[model samples]
Target: MKITNETLATQLNHRSIRAFAKKPIAKEQLTAIYEAARHTSTSQFLQQFSILRITDEAKRKAISEIAKQDYVGGNGELLIFLADLNRNAKIRQHLGQDIARLQTADLFFQAVNDTVLAVQNALLAAESMGLGGVVLGSINNEPKKLVTVLELPQLTYPILGLQLGHPAQSPQLKPRLPLEFTVFDDKYPADFSLAEFKDYDKLVHQYYDLRDTDRRVDEFTTQIGSKKLAAHKSSRDEIMAAIQDQGLCLD
Candidate 1:
């Protein structure tokens, strides 16, 4: 394919930036990124999402601790994206509509999808402007603690944290599976094989082992298998209860 637009190039070269320089992002840049995210599509136009930029140093440090990712607080900005239905719930109360309907599993997943889409837009906007970031799944390590720290309201659930800044390192671009393995035609393929992943596995192995001084130290299969079999952290075990506490009754 022809490298037509710089925007397309930016997306094609995307990589998770873990380390960052100590520079601060300008206010205009942040506003632009937020505006980009605001325009993303939402489920039924619910716009069930919120982005909290962690500005306070102590709070950032505390969240970093909760996430157990020390690099989190060092970014130009740290934003906690939330799947929020609380605003809609309030609107429903005013409109005399049923609030219980929002508690279903469908709404729960839809809100999560909406939140993720907005976050991805923000990431793309930032990256196009030469900014870099990392998504923090580690925030799930202690979701309850995060809720307390952020003081999130009911009907709102923390989905993911994003840390953006001037990149301090340029890691190699990771490999991706071929279209045949991912993109399907009219129907699902009758058969699939683990062996099809072998070639991609070699590429990933080389990427880790040769990219940096501190290598990835494991193959793709090993990584997936280990993560799959790994026990959940104590706090994450109560996820259903926590979601309910946030007023998201996915039952």
Candidate 2:
């Protein structure tokens, strides 16, 4: 028996929508989505997140280049979610209080959490309203470049980019690891084996990605083993330095 509600259905049917229709989202719907994001739970009642809506074609194109995703700058609403402690720092400066704590790694992590939660809330709200979107972690490929592109202030870092619009394609539902492999009891399993993923690997190999319909993507295990976990450093390697440059103390 499948027990589900509207929210559950929306979540279960989630697909990364890269291609979007030319139609613009209604102002009221956009407002509702923003409101939902604003109302997301914050750590210690400290809302450390900020959302930047990118409408300028030039900026969008620059961000797309940073992400290396053409669809990003094409058509849709582009929103960049940021982990921002600059606002709190300003508040403390105004009160003549110590602003050092705001720059700590602990506070930085809290702000990141706030930003990620807000993005989830915003995406779910949009999905509920019959919209489709994709989360662009790719923007972090060049953190410093992204900071320069957005003119991010001190004590703020870009967490993710969200592209929201009406979906133009219906892609196949991506498969996930079974509960036995993911969900565990109070304590984690004592041991696991790669052999356990054989069935899952087969299922994944059979799946076709909309991006490349000509051939099925590599199996889940192979993808992680070869590509995802491979240590080929790039601009992403400077992420920590970029964060520190933004005035966040990681040490």
Candidate 3:
């Protein structure tokens, strides 16, 4: 076996390729990607995840409106990962099984964990095949509307959306915060020491976001500082209500 720079090959080459060429992926490969996702290590083998392939033109158009990004639905393959407890909910209901308060936390955590693991497996499978993707959290901006439009059941909730396609542009590798900032030992480290930021800040200030070409991105602190929560509380609250309404606590 020949030793190659596998880690570098994985990390140094990752770029979110939004622009995909006109090539379409084969059905066999699509089946393989879903197969990879199915085999992902799920918590308790509960398999609490669902994937919605938004292939309908009108539906994708409406979803694109919700996401506020035209490119999301315009992609070659757009998938929405979901945390679905609906399967077990119906199973238990039919079996006359009752869930207790103690089981609530377990169900919540398990679904979240299972869905994330499945999404990761799918993403890695795509990357391994040289396909590129971007996970869009913007879908959460209108969770209830997303649920209604997708016709998701009571116990199923959208997690994140993934836009994947053949790489259309080769972009540069973005730098990461140093090891000290990211890699932690047994326990979490103290707040980022004031002195440690200078180097990282300098490194960050050098890069520009392709989302806004020509202008240099603001420094990290400034970006975070500018981050404002919406004046009106929304979908997050609605989703939580939906979660509780799904009968996980047996209330």
Taking all chains together, each candidate's TM-score versus the true structure is 0.93, 0.96, 0.86
Q: Write the per-residue lDDT of candidate 2 for residues 153-250, one digit (tens) a residue.
A: 99999999999999998877888999999898899999989999999988888775443554756788888878657778788999999999999965
lDDT of 3 by residue, 42-159 (tens): 8778898989998999878888888888788885898998888877777887899854522375777778788888877787778878788777777877766777788876677788
Model 1, 1-251: lDDT tens digits are: 66568888999999999999989999999999999999999999989899999999988999889888789888689999999989899999999998887887789889999999999999999999999999887887787888889988889998988999999999889887778888998998999878888887898888888888566655677778886668766776667787888879657
- Which number leads on lDDT? 2
Per-residue lDDT for 95 in model 3? 90
Whole-model lDDT per candidate:
0.88, 0.91, 0.75
Model 3: how far residue 141 lies from native, Å: 0.9
**Model 1, runs deviating above 4 Å:** 1-3, 227-234
Ranking by TM-score: 2, 1, 3
* Residue 28, candidate 1: C-alpha displacement in angstroms: 0.5
Better of 1 and 3 by lDDT: 1
RMSD in Å for all candidates: 1.8, 1.5, 3.2
Misplaced by over 4 Å in model 2 are 209-214
Predicted structure 1, TM vs. truth: 0.93
